[model samples]
Target: MATTVGVVVFPGTNCEMDAVTAVEGLGGSGRLLWHGDDDLSGVDAVVVPGGFAHGDYLRPGAIARFSPMMGAVARFAADGGPVVGICNGFQVLTEAGLLPGALQKNRGLKFLCQPATLRVETTASALTGRASVGDELSVPINHFEGNYTCDDETLARLRDEDRIVLRYVDNPNGSMDDIAAVCNEGRNVVGLMPHPERACDELLGSADGAILMASLLAAA
Candidate 1:
């Protein structure tokens, strides 16, 4: 059977179509799911694409965290289903408590858009399985609240468990530990500040973003 991937589109979310295109480009069927839908009927995987959900109101992803679709997303991840969140989606995941830490404003306090180099930090995550640890790849990041922050204990625990999946080599946003992406304890849920879907094609720039989506599809 063909894999059916669900990409949740919330109001004000601008990357739904881009993420759908990336998913279809990888030979999977991309299904658009609304934020109010409670059912993830045929989805083998779920994606939360980047955008200013709720117009970045009340914090980057704060309001979107309470959306109806998030309940389903929470259940999906808890059941070991693969879920990937990019940029604003990453913010949503953190707010949803699916991923640890918070994405704060950039240390420079500017909205950035540039190709960033990140080191693949783990092989067990569904998002970074295709890349070996220490391997570096470029992905684009465009956001003001891209800085990752967490308490010392949580940071240490994440490192101890190898839950950190992607680390920015250049640390573009002053994120603690240079962390870019991290997975849950099961390694099935991933959230990162970079817009991987935006980098899926060479026409857009680079294909490095496709690696993570490919890894997610393969996991499905």
Candidate 2:
């Protein structure tokens, strides 16, 4: 059976359709889950795509963390279901406590929109399970607050637990440790600044993200 992937849509979300297209292109079914909805509808996997949630008013994901849908997302993740958060969605995951670390403004206080080369640090998580450690991927990123930050103890634990899933080959936002993506200790929930859905097609620049989505589908 094809996996049913739910793409969460918040008020300001603009990439939900793109995520849905990517999932459907990969032979999976994509469903839109509204932020106000409290049910997951038995989706096999959930994806929080890029876009400013709740206007990014207080902060990137500060407000979206309290949405009703996030409660369902939390429960889904707790059951070990696959969950991948991209760009602003990553911020939401962190704010929701599904993932650790906070995304801060870029070092130079600039918005970045470009292709980034990321090295796969681990394949233990659902997002990167189809890739081998150290494999390089070309993905696109679009965000202002994409710099990842965490305390020393959290950083040490992430390193010790192999939770860091991707690292920028050439750091663009001054993220600590050049980290581009990470996953929860369960390895089921993943959050990344890069937009894998935007890079899933070769015609669009790179097809490397297909590998990541394929892994997510398999895990789902």
Best candidate according to lDDT: 2
| TM, every model | 0.98, 0.99
Expressed as tens digits, the lDDT of each residue in 1-220 for candidate 2 is 7899999999999999999999999999999999999899769999998899899989988999899999999999999999999999999999999999999999987899999999999999999989999999999989899999999999999999999999999999999999999999999999999998988899999999999988999999
Question: How much is the lDDT of residue 50 in candidate 1?
Answer: 90
What is candidate 1's local distance difference test score?
0.91
Give one digit per residue, the lDDT tens place, for model 1 in 1-220. 7788899999999999988889899998899989988899989999998989999898988999898899999999999999999999999999999999999889996889999998999989979877778888899999889999999999999999999999999988899999999999999999999888888899988999898888889887
Model 1: lDDT of residue 184? 92
lDDT score for candidate 2 against the true structure: 0.94
